[model samples]
Target: MMKRYYQDEEDIGLFQRMQQDDSQAFEEIYYRYFLKLSNTAFKRLQDRAATEEIIQEFFVNLWLKRHRLPELKNPESYLQTLLRNSVIDWFRSQTRQDGFAAERMAQPDYQIANATEQQILYADLQRAYESTVGQLPDKCRQVYTLHQRGYSVNDIAEQLQIAPKTVESHLLKAHTTLRHLLKDYSAVTITLASLLMG
Candidate 1:
């Protein structure tokens, strides 16, 4: 929930590296946020085991979708949002969403209305994100995915056993394609693109 001034540059750099599949960056992100994410989950579910599972799952999923991740504006907020969604899914799976919805509805009208709108917007954005990413060519998509997850150019080169130039070429094409694909989401194009692609 907090961003340190001194670590801001480092965090951004770390994410950039993670986008390229950097284990060090991935480990740092996990270590740095695991406890915070766990606490946030525990607060929502009040179940220690469930909270741990949710947080761990989120980190793993993030790695799986790293190629699709964008430059995160707020890493903590990003993880919180992921955890919130996970908790909601957990509640639904457990057949508790009805009660949870009722409790949420009992909140002040202003809060409920705002949250509702935000939820709808986020859902739409997520769909659009998937749609756009699904359009990339296979190799470009793979490169984009690997790089966004924190694989540096050289890392991707070594991992893919390709030349660094090839990795950069794929990255360039992926960026260009993504820009053209998401041009219509002018309002959130930049922010969403960053979030969806590192």
Candidate 2:
């Protein structure tokens, strides 16, 4: 008479057969582990639909990569570790996406706030602004910074030993270059740049 096989004996036999590419053994393993793996993932993710999707993906990858799977001293521990790592990766990706979305939503509001601040701070739009200051002719840049620091155009002209008309020309040229360079940005980028310069 043949002896009866215990369920654990059946499982070990299935596992050994799986190493030899036995489809039935692989299906048996899947049936045994799927519920436990899904439950573990669900505990971490909380969302039923997302948890189900994650577990399904995990098992599919497991089957696809079965040949490369390591020899396990404890198959259950190995599976649980894989599930935990998958859940951790899912949460990490969710955090990064949330941060990016928040930054995008805040950008326009940040621009608006910056514009309100810039209105009180500087005048002359060209030479007084940092973006265009660097692009000016060397003497123009020096005269502009003096005017930005509260010197009159005449005072800048006297201090730099240039004509007042030369100071005006430098300021105008600086402004024109800034407008050209910044034309591609939205109003928000302009405001933000102004705030940063200030």
Candidate 3:
């Protein structure tokens, strides 16, 4: 997955205040990204209780390490990377505790783990695509959806009673918007292609 720098001036200012032991700044940061981070964690872990625990631990650690936050360029990216690593560590710990040493040590099980990871990544990409598409203008969304569903531009224009050039314009607008919105999900292009083909 491509790392995203979601930090804007507000995020940076919050982190700076948090580094100074400001409780309100810490709370704001927590509320801002908590749901998003939790959703990402739950998608991978697939266990509500474990996901909550992991997320709580992540926040605790973030608080503990606030003094060093100034060194980081993108705090949101750091949170995402740390959460992903934490989930992987949780899986490994589960494997060890479950006495699956043979499977863990052997090479064959690696394929299963890799496949699961790929599925999780695909799920993330799909969510990003859907979310971004949902944000498009109404006409652009209709045009884009029909186009992706294999409708000819002329067909869409006919169905919507618009000129073909208008259809093309909406499509172009959708592409530009999606490209900007989904830049963080670089693999979404592959997902969209496969989805359209399928």
Give the best candidate by TM-score: 3
Considering only N, C-alpha and C atoms within 3 Å, which residue pairs clash in candidate 2? 126-175
Candidate 2 C-alpha error for residue 8, in Å: 5.5
lDDT (CA) for every model shown? 0.64, 0.60, 0.69
User: Which 10 residues in a row give candidate 1 its minimum summed lDDT?
Assistant: 1-10
Per-model TM against the reference:
0.44, 0.44, 0.47
Model 3, 10-70: lDDT tens digits are: 5677888889876567666764566467668877865656776787777777777889764
The number of clashing residue pairs in each candidate reads 23, 1, 0
Estimate candidate 2's RMSD in Å: 30.5
lDDT of 2 by residue, 1-198 (tens): 112232233445666666676555665566455544654665566455566567666765665676787877777777789888889989887767767676864698876765555443323232334555576778878875675565767788888898877877785565446546434321333332343244
Among these predictions, the greatest lDDT belongs to 3
Instruction: Kindly report which residue stretches of model 1 are placed more than 4 angstroms away from their true locations once superposed.
Output: 1-9, 96-198
Off by over 4 Å in 3: 1-9, 100-198
Better of 1 and 2 by lDDT: 1
